[model samples]
Target: MSKWTERMTDLIKSVGGFAKANKPVAEAFHTLETATRADGILDAKTHELIALAVAVTTRCDGCITAHAAAAKKAGASKAEISAALGTAIALNAGAAYVYSARALEAFEEL
Candidate 1:
């Protein structure tokens, strides 16, 4: 189910190989990820937590495992991770509720 964190180094090297094949775009994406993940206003743990939340919403198992590992390494507790996940869940639920209303209106129009 989850192999990303289990073999993160391999996955990263594989990405490098893929980027080499894809040329500029993939390489640029890697660079962008590096820049985005760098410690800025928020610490690494906070960033990783946010990334985990995004991973859940996107249904990316690899991302979930990877960011979670990173978050743990960055000193985030299980409770903090749970809280971040809760926010993602709440946001997704809220989005569904709002979109359901839109869908209903569209159905009425049709």
Candidate 2:
């Protein structure tokens, strides 16, 4: 009913269609996902929080919705999520700063 819920529902359907059309690639991705999560170094909540932060940085709406729900299910609090997002914000700014230096170098050269 809500905007995010509707988007997630549609995303699920689309992913299903993609899997059906490309079973091998889908299965491979699933395998990779499972293998990564199989490592017990991080708990589910921490993993979901990291995934949500990466999703924000990558600008993936589907990933955001998926990881947001997963983070909630894993008992990540709102403040925890905000902290993860803060890391993402800092990372993006750092990336921009690095790229700005590169742009300046290019301008000097060209």
Candidate 3:
């Protein structure tokens, strides 16, 4: 198995233990997650890609691994997943770039 695959396996086992110990809370979370992830305007594949992008933006390794696996399972090609990651990178960089303008304005005011 790939490193990510192993990591995901371990993470799932750990989370499963915690969920089992906290069944009520876990079930509530599961219900919420399931409902939110259910198809609406977006298809499952597209949603998985979006989840991957959000995971990247949030710097959550577990989320990245989980969503990458899900995205692949949902038929997202490597190219499509890569594109989603690229969008995350660009948005993060763009946010910093835009904030730099504000930083400069603040310095000028000082």
Q: Which candidate ranks first by TM-score, i.e. highest?
A: 2
Model 2 deviation from the true structure expressed as Cα RMSD, one decimal place: 0.7
Regions of model 1 farther than 4 Å from truth = 1-10, 37-39
Cα lDDT tens digits, model 2, 1-110, are 99999999999999999999999999999999888788789999999999999999999999999999999999999999999999999999999999999999999999
After superposition on all CA atoms, what RMSD does each candidate show versus the true structure? Answer: 2.6, 0.7, 2.3
* Candidate 3 lDDT over residue span 1-110, tens digit each: 98998999998998899899999998998899799767587888999999999999999988898998899899999999989989999999999999999999999999
Question: For candidate 2, which ten residues in a row score worst on lDDT?
Answer: 32-41
> What TM-score, computed on C-alpha atoms, does each candidate reach?
0.83, 0.97, 0.82
Candidate 3: worst 10 consecutive residues by lDDT? 33-42
Better of 1 and 3 by lDDT: 3
Clashing pairs in 2: none
lDDT by residue for model 1 over 41-60, one digit each (tens)? 77898899999999999998
TM-score of 1: 0.83
Model 1 residue 71 lDDT score: 94
After the best TM-score superposition of candidate 2, give how far the Cα of residue 46 lies from its true spot, in angstroms: 0.3
In angstroms, how far off is 108's CA in candidate 3?
6.8
What overall lDDT, based on C-alpha atoms, would model 2 receive against the true structure?
Answer: 0.97
> What is the TM-score (0 to 1) of candidate 2?
0.97
